[model samples]
Target: MMRYTLNKMLLRLQNRYNYDVRYQQDLLQTDLAAFLKFMAFQSMSSHQGNLAAAPLYAARLRAIIFEDCGPCTQLVVNMALEAGVSAAMLRAIIEHDLHQLPEDIALVVQFTELVLAHQPQADLLREKIMALWGSKGLMAIGFAISSYRVYPALKYALGYGKTCSRIQLNDASLVPNRAAVVAAEAQNVE
Candidate 1:
């Protein structure tokens, strides 16, 4: 009975988001306890902790994009849209149009990239984040960047991850800029 209920809930989420949750379904079928624990991580990923929709989604989309360019990235994009992030801003992020992004979003993107790259330069941006949104804001960004990567990693580990695909925002079909990711990785290697 619990399994049936959970399956229904997963179906609802898949339908609502137009996303593939097959990895989650596999987890549920193979290990109910792990499934529950995995699902519980949503709370950690979603603790906004006083973040406004823009900066919060900025961090989320950036982090997810770094980790995935396929369905998982699309999922975050859709959620960000539902959360009221402007399509233009989202387009800027995905397209890597740094010049076009709004100030706060640009800051979050820079910070997210630095942190993900494990670069000490993030410290300066961290200070900027603290000045703008305080520790709660910093915590929210931290959770978003760290937790959003888990879904794609789990999907790949379970053999359910897909290759990069075009991301759609409203009527616009945008390709994620892999150059930034490649550049970040190159920096890590240096």
Candidate 2:
């Protein structure tokens, strides 16, 4: 009965987001204990605390693009739009046009990039974030960047992850900049 309810809920999620949740379903079938644990983790990933929607979603979208350039990325974009982030700002983040974004949002984007790239330079940006949004807001950004990547990681581990592709937002199909990935890879090799 619990499995049936969980399956129904997953279907509702898929229909609502137009996303693939086969990997989640696989978890449900293969391991009920793990599936329950995964659902608990979702609460952390959805935490925004005191951070406003724009910066929170900004961190999420940027972090997601690093791990996933396909449907999962699109899902975050859709969620951001629904959370009321401006379309233009979303475009700037996707295009890596940090100059055009408002200073706070650009800070979040740059911070997320640095953290994901494992660069210590994010410390200064983290300080700025704390000053603007308080420590809880800073924690919100931390959870946003860290937890959102788990979805794509799980999908890929389950063989449901797809190759990178253009993400559709409104009428425009935008591709996230690959330069960050390249730079991260280059750093990893050194």
Candidate 3:
């Protein structure tokens, strides 16, 4: 979709302008295993949702995390801190959820749980992110990382990252409650 082409352009801009990185370098850095992990996250997209909506939701999540995380160098780390999810725990959760993606195709039943839990209130969230990342120049970083999430989802949809095993999803819903994986993992992924 042409919308996606714009998304690609946006990502390039974030890296080039914000991270001082070249597009090709970002592409090369993606490990097959990590890429697979992101794909699983994508699979959590709407099980009963329109194909388009799932990506939109994923984009929003990326936006929140990236903005919260400081986008350029410490994007992943700060998102984990603000959302209270840890990198290692996030790795484990992604591993779990990707392995058992929703059975159907329309709406991403599983990931809704995650989306709901992680979506932060703008009023409540901005300060913490600012304190950790600074208020000035924190623009569009969320858009960049949210966009980044698509990459892994694409990979997982294609099916990669098998060797990078972890617990995998279960009877549990993928909701983003305060006690949810993201919050609890905030303590640590260990």
Task: Name the lDDT of candidate 3.
Answer: 0.34
Question: After superposing candidate 1, which stretches have Cα over 4 Å from the reference?
Answer: 181-190
For model 2, residues 27-64, the per-residue Cα lDDT tens digits are 99999999999999999999999988889988898888
Candidate 3, residue 183: the lDDT equals: 52
- What's the ranking of the predictions by lDDT, best on top? 2, 1, 3
The CA lDDT of each predicted structure is 0.84, 0.86, 0.34
Clashing pairs in 1: none
**Count of residue pairs whose backbone atoms collide, per candidate:** 0, 0, 26
All-Cα superposition RMSD per candidate: 2.9, 3.4, 16.1
Model 3 CA deviation exceeding 4 Å by range: 1-118, 135-137, 140-144, 161-179, 183-190
On the 0 to 100 scale, the lDDT of residue 39 in model 1 is 79
Candidate number with the higher lDDT (1 or 3):
1
Please give, for residues 78-173, the per-residue lDDT of candidate 1 as tens digits: 888998989999999887676798877888887888888787778877888999999999999999999988887888889998877899899999
User: Model 3 compared with the native: what TM-score?
Assistant: 0.27
lDDT of 3 by residue, 22-117 (tens): 332233344545534544554443131222322233334433332222222133323333445444334332333433333221012222223334
Q: List the residue pairs that clash in candidate 2.
A: none
